[model samples]
Target: MARPVISCERHSLRGLLAVALALLLVCAVSAGVSAGQAGAQGLTPQQLAGQRVIYSYRGLTPPQSLLDDIRAGRAAGVIFFGENISSPEQIAGVVAQLRQAQAESPISRPLLLMTDQEGGLVRRLPGAPVPSAKQVGQSPDPVAAAFDAGLGAGRNLRGVGMNVNLAPVLDVFDTPGNFIDRTQRSFSDNPFAVAALGSAFITAQQGTGVAATAKHFPGLGTAPAGQNTDTGPVTLPADLSRLRSVDELPYPAAVFVGVKLVMLSWAIYPALDADRPAGLSPMIVDRELRGRNGFRGVTITDALEAESLNAFGTTGQRAVAAAAAGMDLILCSARDTGQGESATTALADAYAGGQLDPAAFDQAVARVDALRAGLR
Candidate 1:
């Protein structure tokens, strides 16, 4: 009966439909396999690890080792320090060489040439445009002055081929002789004043196409005896409510004005998390800075080589911990290439071994890439 009913057109159509279905299934299986292999094969370990690290090197131009690292996609950027500077033109030359080296790498994202150009003593580049944060803070029209200062700083930074200026110290330290105030870094003891001034600087810098960083998050204003975290571990004794009201005040304003990055302090806050430094604490990095304060910018560790992290672990371990804690950029500004290389290696190993949270790593990289994209 079926033999009498079947037509050639209908028989051919059925065969084609069956073939299409098989092909679709095969494609789906192939895609699944590729996705499964992606974690191990899609991105090299160096790429994953290097994307998270910002390193410093010795000499006017980037060292050959650094150039090799850049070419191999094993370095994110170079940070300029006091020794790396002689003049604006000299720094410009060095940055030009870095870009030239980066061109050899397959990664198209521009290297984040950054410095602690926060004005006053912290300004790494010579001839910074703005005066000390104290000078700006105490100015007759602080907001406007800060705006001008930020503009000047941004212009100078961009002039030398640097794209990121780690400035606008947002700490609200009120304690007499605290490092934040003594260094002329904090805008003011008053959080609202700090907020206003910091926002102005952030606005002006980013407006000039140079990204601004609001630093030492949650405040270092109250460190007893002006205790420096760089020499050893220190704790912020303020309770959660005080920290929110006092220490964290400046960040919201900075966030409101669209700061591009927030430098996490190495100082531990018992109110946030008692056991770990802020840069190594999820409660401080993810919960407080990102969640509570609504800072959507990149999260960077202050410096991995800081002695504050000595109690925690070695530089490599600290770097991995910082990433796991939610930091996007690992700052290895101590002038030792080994520290940066070792840290990158450790991070890559951790990610490859499934020691780091995959979601966290992806989010960190996304934020970092997005920030870098802003420079381009």
Candidate 2:
């Protein structure tokens, strides 16, 4: 016998309940999937495809345009200057506010807040009751002094919610008239002393959960007399033996002790790379520091907006080139006025135009991510 045919209009109430229940299950599953995607941290390949670093004007507060770019993961980092400082309390407030904005941003990663707290003339938080590197170097026990000073500086910075301190000028300070060293920013003229004090500072700062960066790497210690690399393209005429002995000594010590960031100098080292400054030379960054030196941390460029590279290219072009040359971070100090903004925008444009290779960009982002992830 043929089974009784049930018309659609005559469907049982039980069948209707089952259909409704199935639909509800599907909706619940869909909702979960959407939530998972929303909760994911970091940017997708499409998001970071075309991005760069930017700076804000002091006393003007962070602009909506800059904030929007950062929230969209189009900006890399911010470089703080002396003008960005008011008082320790005020500085702390600004740092906290920046972090809050980052937390609310769609990008889940933390914003890299950088400052040139290298002590003496380069210090951002001056008069914070901390001793200069010169003072630490002059102490009978330089290592102990550096450790204590670094601890104090780290505590003060961490209290203010800052995570990075661009410090412990690795430059040897051989030139007595050198502006950076004449002001006592360098630890010592003796390479061993510099290495010892620098390593101590790195340990002490990182010990307190603040990442310490060794600055002006490959040794700005050998700059020409009466010339600062900040204002011009200074060159050092050291032989390979001199560089290895005096310039490159402190770097290995810094790496061996776990310093997380190293900032490359903009000065030219004819002995190393005559055509390009260390900041823009792949041989210096990739071959020398990364390969020969075996440094596995993040490498940043000194301010691209500095006069050192003003003749080479626009701030944006220099920044893009630095990244291509293997720098993980590009600094654009506000001291350059609006140049930082232009450079950052240029980097964003480069990313969009495919001038920056995707693989290289991803590699940089990954290294930065790893270093930050390991931070306490």
Q: Specify the poorest-scoring 10-residue window by lDDT in model 2.
A: 27-36
lDDT of 1 by residue, 162-197 (tens): 999888888886777778777888777777667766
Q: Give each prediction's root-mean-square deviation over alpha carbons.
A: 18.1, 20.4
**Model 1 clash pairs?**
173-221
Model 2 clashing residue pairs (backbone):
none
- Local distance difference test, per candidate? 0.77, 0.68
TM-score of each: 0.87, 0.83
Off by over 4 Å in 2: 1-56, 127-129, 335-341
Error of 2 at 246 (Å): 1.0
State the TM-score for model 1: 0.87
Model 1 / residue 323 / CA error / Å:
0.7
